[model samples]
Target: MKSIVAVQFIAAVFFATAAHAEDLEFVLVNDSSSDLVEFNVSPASSGNWEGDLLDSGYLAPNYEVGVLIADGLQTCVYDIRGVFDDGSSVEDYSLDLCDLGEYTFLD
Candidate 1:
């Protein structure tokens, strides 16, 4: 009976830890002009960014692209575009996640 109780307690702890992970996504766009441009998306907390090329042949005016944020950190998105490109744009949308408080186990 004691062994069964110990196994149940371990399973409960594992499940609780798995519930706190978060995932997020955002979109980027170009609003004006018909020129080829390149842009990058980055996580504000980690300072890690990825670059994508958006040229006249690949991207259209006012086009949107989606990006994914990794787990275990609070993230904010940013838009990095070339200056030669003409357009007004916005970035930095965040995902929603649960807040974990102190936990207690009882008999």
Candidate 2:
């Protein structure tokens, strides 16, 4: 009986940790008139922008891709930036990615 209780406690702890470490995922869409050459995201509290998530790939106009934020940060607010092939860039501040299931960048 003691061994069974210990196993159950371990399982409960494992499940709780798994649930808390889940990754935040969302779809990124390009609705602009140009191709997106760069896509970057960073926590709202951090002033620095991380590397591009595209990894040498480009999102053409009217296209979309799935994005996963696995940084394990606690905050849901983030800053998103996209650079277009037309030499122009756009940015969004304080976006709640948890509630934003999908994001579309418009021209």
Candidate 3:
């Protein structure tokens, strides 16, 4: 019957909700000589840079922070940029988020 089919579909949806895939996550480690004022991440194939992930905040020197790639992200390779305290910035492109679980800005 139609009602029976609807009930079965509802049940299947409820049961499948718990089988979601693990989200991509990464840690940004600061190894540079100065503190990080801003950190940004975007798809490597894109031409323009997006907004700052830090907004008005910062990542201190010798510290690190975790970033989660939100669900529905289409690309795996990402570009990252970190602005140092001395007004200098570093950019890394074509880094795969799934492959590199952790990234460090070298001195």
Candidate 4:
């Protein structure tokens, strides 16, 4: 009976910790040239969860490409690489993100 009670208490604490986590969304764009391009965005380090936001062969024109990331209380560095469909490529760029809200790019 004592073992059963201790197990339940541990399980409750584990679930409670997992529930109060922060979720972040990462938004990337290719505001460089006027051509259709593909890119891959991933976390800089290992054991970091990069949530689902975009897919392969995704065309991110001179606009904003949004991606959603899992909830966590850690600084996440994203790697953005421009992958061209044809035999061409573009320069790599960096994005500054925060937990405020979405970013809007104006002309």
Candidate 5:
């Protein structure tokens, strides 16, 4: 009986961790007229951009992209940077990922 209880407790802990991790992910929407040529997610506490989350591809205009904060960081706040094809950029700082399910990049 003790073993069973221990297993269930571990399972619950695992699920909670998974849910917390999922909360750090959000969808990035491009609300501008130009394509999103660049994108990145950085920890708010780091003061340095981790790297481009969009990799080599471009997020087209009026499209939505999924983004996840840096791995293994116990942070809910982050900085988002989006660059458009028209040489314009938008930057947001200290945004809570759990509070923002969908972020719209506007002009």
Candidate 6:
């Protein structure tokens, strides 16, 4: 039996993965059973969730995609939100993207 779960990882090994100082581009892995419908990334200090990074199609289970946080902000700390097809969502707070080369949403 499989259970839906959300896992967070932030290791020191990912510290130098970003291309540049301000670029927050990383690979998003959807390991959860449900399809990911929408993905949002916003500054940790802000109250509102930013635009959908997924844009159009949903990210199916076991699939992954590369996301570029083109906000152009110098800050690396941000909040992440992922909405699934089963009406369930996961939220991660104050993540330093510059140190995270990849993020996986587990099941």
Could you tell me every candidate's TM-score relative to the true structure?
A: 0.37, 0.79, 0.74, 0.42, 0.74, 0.78
Which of the predicted structures, 3 or 4, would earn the higher lDDT when compared with the native? 3
Off by over 4 Å in 3: 1-22
Ranking by TM-score: 2, 6, 5, 3, 4, 1
Please list all clashing residue pairs in model 1, or write none if there are none.
none
Better of 4 and 5 by TM-score: 5
Scanning candidate 5 in windows of ten residues, the lowest lDDT window is 1-10
Of candidates 4 and 2, the better by lDDT: 2
TM-score: which candidate is best?
A: 2
lDDT of 4 by residue, 1-107 (tens): 01111110000111123444544554444444443344443444433323223343444345554454443534445444455445465433334344524432211
Tell me, what's the RMSD of every candidate? 18.7, 13.8, 15.1, 15.3, 12.7, 8.3
Cα misplacement distance, residue 88 of candidate 3 (Å): 1.1
TM-score of 2: 0.79
The residue ranges of model 5 lying beyond 4 angstroms of the native Cα positions read 1-23
Off-target runs (Cα >4 Å) in candidate 2 are 1-19
Total backbone collisions, model 5: 0
lDDT of 2 by residue, 38-76 (tens): 888887888887787776668888777778777766668
lDDT for each residue of candidate 1 in 1-107, tens digit (9 for 90 to 100): 01111111100111122344454443433344543254444444435544443323233444444334344443333333332244433343332212211111111
Residues 11-102 of candidate 5: C-alpha lDDT, one tens digit per residue? 01112233335436666777788988878777687767655556656777667755645365556787878888899999999998878888
Q: Relative to the unseen true structure, what is the Cα RMSD of model 3?
A: 15.1
Candidate 3 vs candidate 4: the TM-score winner is 3
Worst 10 residues of 1 by lDDT: 4-13
List clash counts for every candidate, in order: 0, 0, 0, 2, 0, 0
